[model samples]
Target: MKRTVITVDGNGMLSIPSNLQDLWMSEGELVDMLHVTAMKLHAVIRSIYKDGLLTVSEVQQKQETSNGIWQTLY
Candidate 1:
């Protein structure tokens, strides 16, 4: 996992790092990527709360399932 520190603006908006922003733009639009990322995070949080400490494989499986469901919906 790659990590970077970012600052939120006075209005609570976040500034995407330039490299990450470029990646998102390549895939689609930044807003759409952010929305999908938020949804994935929500799913991960729920899974963690329900199941407790997960292994890497377990987390990846959960993420794949969650992504599949979201893709089906949207």
Candidate 2:
């Protein structure tokens, strides 16, 4: 796997590259994600606060993982 650095706009938004957008099934889908980082062969993630902003935070009880795997690669 390879990693690419993408720039976020002043509003912290990124423009998905056309080719990459097509590569991902979740491209246009609504997804709840905490954080994302791609380095070398890894794509790391974790639960995000309901609202993905710096100041606002989600409580601990609300951070537990739910049953089963919502996403996994074969």
Candidate 3:
């Protein structure tokens, strides 16, 4: 995993770090991808807040299940 610090401006805008911006541009043309990713991240944060922290194995299991479902649907 990689980590970087970002600041929210007074106007509530966030500037994407340069490294991540490059990856996003290479991946697809859809700007909606960022919104979808943010929503998924919010869901994970909410789950942690409600249920407490998850163990690594528990997180991996959930990820596998999510990927399976996504693959099946796609």
Candidate 4:
């Protein structure tokens, strides 16, 4: 986990730092995020905009790759 301090914009927008931005991308923009308090390390999380499990396109671009070792070469 990484952390950095950023300024909230006049209208209250939070900009993620450059490096962390690469990890969490959304809607062609980095998501506007908030942290909720939880007892456990991993909390039951939800996206700010969507109601439930996110759509592939809405969350990020989708690409498919196969593990080369999975094939039967014989």
TM-scores of the models, in the given order? 0.24, 0.21, 0.25, 0.23
Go through the candidates in order and give each one's C-alpha lDDT. Answer: 0.42, 0.30, 0.39, 0.37
The predictions' CA RMSDs to the true structure, in order, are 14.0, 13.0, 14.4, 12.3
Q: Candidate 2 overall Cα lDDT vs. reference?
A: 0.30
lDDT of 3 by residue, 20-72 (tens): 42222211112233445645655764688568676433333111232454111
- What is the C-alpha lDDT profile of model 4 across 1-74, one tens digit per residue? 23233545777887657775435432212222333333221223334225556543554433222553321110
lDDT of 1 by residue, 2-74 (tens): 3233445667697767664222121113235455675565676567757777643443321123245421111
TM-score of 1: 0.24
Q: What is the C-alpha local distance difference test score of candidate 3?
A: 0.39
By lDDT, the candidates rank as: 1, 3, 4, 2
The lowest-lDDT stretch of 10 consecutive residues in candidate 2 is 55-64
lDDT of 2 by residue, 8-61 (tens): 566768755555522222211213222433331132223233235322222111
Count backbone overlaps in model 3: 0
Clashing pairs in 4: none
Tell me, by lDDT, which candidate is best.
1
Candidate 2 residue pairs in clash (backbone atoms < 3 Å): none
Once superposed on the true structure, which residue ranges of model 2 sit more than 4 Å away at CA?
Answer: 1-5, 21-74
Q: After superposition, how far is residue 37 of candidate 3 from its true place, in Å?
A: 21
2 against 3, candidate with superior TM-score: 3
| Candidate scoring better on TM-score of 3 and 4 | 3
